[model samples]
Target: MTKFRFYFPDNKDFVDPNFDGRSNNRTKYHRQYDDDHYPHQILAELPYDGMLVSLAGVGTMQKRGKYYDQELTEDFYFSGARKFLRLDSSEYERIRLMGDCGAFDYHNEYEPPFTVDELIEFYDRGGFDYGISLDHIVFPYFKDEEAKDVAAEKCDLHELIAESERRIDITLKNAKEFYVKSQNYQFEAYGVAHGYDKNSFIRSVKELQEIGYRRITIGGMIKSKTDELLELLECLNRIRESDTQFHLLGICRFENIPAYINAGVTSADSTSPLMQGLKAGKYYSVNPNSIRFSESLMIRVRQYDHDNVQKHIDKYRDELRQYISELQDNNGFDIDLSSAALSVNECVKRLEIDCLKKLQQYDETGLDLDVTLKALIAYERVTNENYLPSKSTESKQTQLKRNEDKYHQFLLAREWRQCTCGICKGGLMNIIFRSNQSNRRRGIHNLAIVTKHKNNVLKSINPAAK
Candidate 1:
């Protein structure tokens, strides 16, 4: 049976939960979290075995150009309600600080970013377990050519073909150099293969194998369709030696992992799960049978409108006050009208500020407050069911659809408490709602879950080996 591993890409501050600032800050200005309270500390302790660090991401984080001076590293500090010194590359390069690199960042560049010697030194210093040789790429379906055309003049077919051949040659040369130099290092090196088509990909793989690489990584598939990527994997599987392993680069969707594994992919890497939690409208949920997506309150904040956010705040506040009065007068409830009104007003004020901030940050121009108000009202209804006034049939139905997945997930977390993961300990609602800490912690939790799932799949497929 083929063994499979999952590698996570380090996309600057996205995958690094220890990133500093107001949680929503996702630019070059962000700094690393302090050592004592590194958000990824829990993740580091998890049994995740592989990491893929992008050289570009590292360069960006270090605020350097395409390449940085390896010897010069610095720590940055942020001053706010929470202030701490950031980790420099020197600090992050330690094995104890970061785990074994299952794969190193190599891309399709005109020139190799690091020479074989420099890469070897880096791998040795970082205590990496594996390294992928640098390679140039020719994107699938002539997308690269199209992109180039958009930037300048259109390339003729002959020119495109020549470019592809040149990329392959450079890749092969880099692989040969790496293999020759890697003899001095303890870490294993995997040659990278990039091509424009299935046959070319197989040819690249064969050439790498001939160059003494038993393991190879497939590149240039990031832009390929799922079917195209699968076809390439199948072709590689057919031609590859029995002992040879293949790593699929940049294809990390959880749903696709099983398919790739089935197609004979030995390992794969992606930053999708973490990225989704941080940037997308939904959070990834662990379900072996199917991929589940739960609504993220962070997305709600991002989608909030500034034009009429005030209207929503006012509407919700009035509704909440009316509901509280109804409960006290009609239901003869012992609700303190003044305190309830004050609480409602305070929440509305906070909601308005949150909405405005999101609007300004995202640069959205619209005036739809209904969805925002509905979400808040739904939460209020859920939390204070008995005291809240019953919704009208139309409003109730609308809210039911909106709240179904969130409510279900919340109940699941509450009842089973099945996930004792670090993030869950903070409360499931925190993971579900909008906040820097909550979103990042949820992302970490998602990583743990997905990694475990991938490992389990591997075990089930290769039960006798372990």
Candidate 2:
């Protein structure tokens, strides 16, 4: 049995909630901020082994005055990957560092801007245990039958084939040089493979083996459908050499894990599980993991995403709360300030705060589900936040009712308390609260689940390793 490796791509995702969900200068890039806890540091303190970090930071883009800057925000010019991530200490021995060229960053280009020597220099500076050679992207089969978007309009068969073959030639040529020159470098090297079709893909892999490259990564398959990818893997498995290893780039389908392993994947990495938790309405829930596991389901919680309108709501709620406190000083805590002299906006702001208090209270005691959610529905209608519900001319009453139904299902189950991970140990409310800090914590929790299942599956395959 081949010992499969599971690598997680680090994105510096988790943040300090106190800094409005932003990392400060102290703990922004480094890992040694022990005093404040930085929410106790999940990727470092947790059992997040087999970590993969990119040289240019994958999907790195920032907007300037008129145009966007493709440069990664981290000043890696002075510090290496480990130092920048604050993983230089011996405590993070579990994290097996892998450096990636982030070829997807320049996928649209005719050729990679950075050379093989430049990547090798980056790998040496990163102090990585494993590194992938640079390769240009080869798009999956795209013709008149497939594309739904404007890519269909610009589909030129002659230009597409010509461009794809150009990428393949350069990638293979560069891989040969990279693997041969990699003898001087410290990190173990893997040549990247790119091709448009299955026959072309197999031919590229064969050339890689002839170049004395034992490890080969199949690139440009991110857009390929599951069945198409499996067919390619099946073909590759027939010609797979015992000594050589294979890895799939940017594709991890947790729904069909056994199929991929059976098709022969020694290692793979993906950010989907953790990122799903980060996105609104994309909540991932899993069955209890034993030696044998079941399928995981992503429950789409239908509710208004208040992140964008939260600042405005917060401002109104704060002002109203202060005024109410002053009113309470004159009358009493039990006094009916509901009938006090106030505008419609002030009344709505007060309602929003009241609804929020009930929601928080429900999180603690798990009581008042109906009344609290009803109050929330009323407040949601009053505020009319920037979500689709507000934009559409649909029945507000019907939308609010659907929101209540979803919240009822979500809250009644209490999925947050299911984990024994370090993040879940804090409090249930913190994990499920409608805030970025909560969303990130929830995502990291899902990653823990994913990590466990991957290890267990591999353990089942190779029992003697442990």
Writing each residue's lDDT as its tens digit, candidate 1 over 1-466 gives 6556676654433333333223343335443432224334554435244556543333322334232233222221112101111223343332222221122334444655655555555455554568777666666443344544563454575677678788789879988998998878777888988887676888998998898998788877887777767777888888888767788877765556667776667777776667676666345445655443233333233223333444544556667666645544653222234454476655444444543443333222223334333344433442333324454566665665566556434433442135655655433334644555556666666677777677666665668856
For model 1, what is the C-alpha lDDT against the true structure?
0.55
Number of backbone clashes in candidate 1: 0
TM-score of each: 0.64, 0.77
Candidate 2 on 1-466: residue-level lDDT in tens?
Answer: 6456667776666555333211112235443232223222553235345677765553222221111123433344346667656666787666677877777767777777677877787778767888898788897553223442445476765678778899899999888889988999889999888877777788898999898888889888888888888888888877777677888888777655676677667778887766777774345554545533332222221223355445545645555444555534654232244664765455555665666667667766789887666666555543554322324455655765666677677767766556566675555444553565666776777677776676667666678757
Poorest lDDT segment (10 consecutive residues) of candidate 1: 76-85
Best by TM-score, which number? 2
- The CA lDDT of each predicted structure is 0.55, 0.64
Instruction: Tell how far residue 291 is off in model 2, in angstroms.
Output: 11
- Report the Cα lDDT for candidate 2: 0.64
Residue 335, candidate 1: C-alpha displacement in angstroms: 12
Residue pairs in steric clash, candidate 1? none
Number of the predicted model whose lDDT against the real structure is largest: 2
